[model samples]
Target chain A: MKKRAQEVERALDVLLPLPEGPEKRLIEAMRYAVLGGGKRLRGFLVMEVASLFSVAPACAARVAASVEMLHAYSLVHDDLPAMDDDDLRRGQPSCHKAFDEATAILAGDALLTRAFEVLVDVDTHSDSQARCELVAALGAASGARGMVGGQMIDMLSEGQDLSGAEVTRLQALKTGRLIQYSAEAGAILGRAPSHQRHLIAAFGRDLGAAFQIADDILDTEGTAEEIGKTAGKDEAAGKATMVSIMGLEQARAHASMLAEQAANYLSSFGEKAANLVALTDFVVSRRS
Target chain B: MKKRAQEVERALDVLLPLPEGPEKRLIEAMRYAVLGGGKRLRGFLVMEVASLFSVAPACAARVAASVEMLHAYSLVHDDLPAMDDDDLRRGQPSCHKAFDEATAILAGDALLTRAFEVLVDVDTHSDSQARCELVAALGAASGARGMVGGQMIDMLSEGQDLSGAEVTRLQALKTGRLIQYSAEAGAILGRAPSHQRHLIAAFGRDLGAAFQIADDILDTEGTAEEIGKTAGKDEAAGKATMVSIMGLEQARAHASMLAEQAANYLSSFGEKAANLVALTDFVVSRRS
Candidate 1:
């Protein structure tokens, strides 16, 4: 437990608010939005995979922190009216809700920009090759081609019925790509090869698919009291989620199957990626 | 010139308009914002510096492209309502004006994220030291403590009273840091040491201050027809510009003084950084 917490504390440092200045109040707000709480799960995945490579905790921690910054930026933007229109995030006031619309927009903009800033700053990345690759992976995941793209589709298909494949594609881009990058980043630092990259990709994709399904189930079945946030958003939004298209039981079964597949993929790493192994299980086990 | 244009075009093929999916549309737009029309002077600065270090055009291009992305993103966000609220940029419809506000916002966010992504993906930057340093420099420039912070001060100070020193502080944070990073990043790629980095810093700072002071002058004296976008905004908004507070004649003199100081700093580069040397005069001389 102590070890787990020490790792978490290190991760938190990456999440800590940036130095203060009189001019950038909105940036200050953005830092506040990121610094506020949630699972910090994405950072954990980065660190966990790095540990598997025996790459030292600090190196992984930097990448992990970088990923967290990306995630926070997405959340801040997602909560805006053009996207989810969410008034709250992480059980607290959303960035836009807490700040004005323009401030929120600028804050989110700055946060996304700052995420890259944090990444390029870390002493661990070495040369441009290592730094650039990590930046590419994260950028692709976050941009319209990935998470933002997924979001665009989600918005357009709000009331339309999407196929199972469509649902998976959306989830894969929106959710899975980042996860893929998280694990793959560890592999990059670990100096894993093309074949290993394939395995990690499969694991991340399956895990992301399962994770999305589980989220669908949770939103449909979990209560706000238990989940600490609103649920049933998929149905209300008329969104075509795995549960919406496949039915809740089938979605649950699919999630289970995917989680199993994810675990199996990690077998190649032996025990090096044990926590990553555990995380697959943890992803599907969440109530919220 | 032919060779340089070819290189820029080839890189654009690899980089621009990011193909056609909706998820990638914003990425494409962001790419477009940075790609067409202008002389690509900033990109030129990066590649030229890299060449001096014996780095390939390919490696240098990546760094150049990344900074351009940063510049483009800032421009897009700056054009938004809460900031400059301009309807045109680069003599065309602004990103927000051309696209919708929401899409423009996401595009800026994506580009900012992509700059780091470009840095992270550089296959050649295996030397983690250089990559890490580059990333750190970028992060500092983009974050609230740097460019965004400066912008915030610029925004808040609008229509308010301010002393000359206060204006200098704002210009340094808002403008100087990015230019400083551009020079610093190239020096870093060249594996430059402290003295060289310091020299570039001095050059960038002096040049940036002059460039902004010129902008203040343009905002007063230049027409919308001449500048390609809204002019006289500083005066209209009662912005705490160098010209508004100190008068245009004095600001012009200061700009010249700054340009001279910036040119003096170029002496340390030993004639190797000739393009950067010319670029200072170019930035200060710009009518637009």
Candidate 2:
């Protein structure tokens, strides 16, 4: 997983070189927001899933980098004063804090646009069909009905009582879709069979649920240094989460169950998906 | 032109119907920001250029609507308090004014994502290559080195002295690239020959230059009622513009010259490009 993260970090550097223009600051902000940060869990998922199909590492790295770019854009925008207003991310100042709010916003916008641009490039996939599918799938995962829509629900549900089902649906849309897309991307690139793709997608969905619940737990228990950002922010903001609705112990139990279920979906792949299975365990039990 | 605008409006409505969910408000903000507004110059450019190659109207309309969606997204984000801070757009309250800042930002992000989504759909083009080309071109035009880059420069250059050349480069990145893409989109959709595509791109480039100068002139001369938004906000914000630097008369003369030059680039198409040539004149002369 660390190796895959390093490869994705290098890929991101190549994809987002600083240009010689007035917009260099924007590019710099984008690089700062994305490069050398995060657990790269999504990147690792893309590479691992692609490896199951024996896909080219370079191609997988490109997709992984694109996902990271999209994720970074989301984080940059989410930290804006109008949104979560986070001042720190990954142990450093957030994009809006590092740069001015306007630059941060433009950086996020440009990063999102660049993510699509990278996916559609010929280098990402020789086949135009695969490239188009990547663009379409990413759009579907990140657009109104997916990540962005999930964010909308998150913002609206703040300080409001939400049932467990409502919270699950919200988390599924907000973050699960992108994580699901990260896993399904390998299937699309490798032209995996429909049934196999469905299995991988299900694996991603369950894994994402487990990941979010674990995140909620971390927010509840981890420190600022351990988590790399503000801890207990969800509780402070009155944001609805599984931990908020079900108590810490119940949430942790549910996350563990979901993680195990996520790993079981890869049973058909046998030893080929061992690392992915291990990842499921890591997501639920990791300290950070 | 009005007919094409209406067609594009209908296409947008079809592409972005509100869903029954918590995110419905986000979609509503997106719809409100895009529908029944603007001169639809970019949409008309796509249709007219597509008509020159006898492309299907349905296909052309889809591309037109996508361009408008992208344009609308830029407008929504640009109007945010952190950016341009305008409360009015197209004679109505802007997205942030009507809804909220967070919703407006998400709506802009979703609109941009949806624009690419629509482009990649099979309904937009039967050939995946064409859809990929559209995606790549739009991404190139709107990404960091394109419209978003231009916005970054615009923000950084506010209240700063800039040379005429610097200002031209800024505007070219900010607005010209997207306008160029809109005209070139028809060629991409129609699968025009490379030479023909280049010609259309050149025409669009010059036309966009003319259109921006005219807009600067409008900001200098017209009222909010005439222009459908705050007219003199540019000068008020101390924003760098051609009219601010070159003065009204020289700017008008330059715009007219560019319009003529833009029309001449479409000379190879002869009468088939009459409407496009007429558009160059209309853009420079229109009050709004």
Scored by TM-score, the top model is 2
How many clashes does each candidate structure show, in the order listed?
27, 0
lDDT of 1 by residue, B171-283 (tens): 88887788778767777888877786787778777887888898788878888887878887877878888887777788888888888888788786667767667777777
lDDT minimum window of 10 residues, candidate 1 chain A: A1-10
- Candidate 2 positional error at B21, Å: 2.2
**B1-288, model 2: which lDDT tens digit per residue?**
989998899899999988897888999999999994899999999999999999989889999999999999999999999999999899999999999999999999999999999998836445888898899899999999899999999988889999999999999999999999999999988889999998999999999999999999999999999998998988898988999899999999999999999999889998999899889999899988
Which stretches of model 2 miss by more than 4 angstroms?
A122-125, B122-125
Cα lDDT of model 1 by residue, A29-65, tens digit? 7766776766766777677766766777776777776
Candidate 1 steric clashes: 27
Q: In DockQ terms, which candidate is top?
A: 2
TM-score to native of every candidate shown = 0.89, 0.98
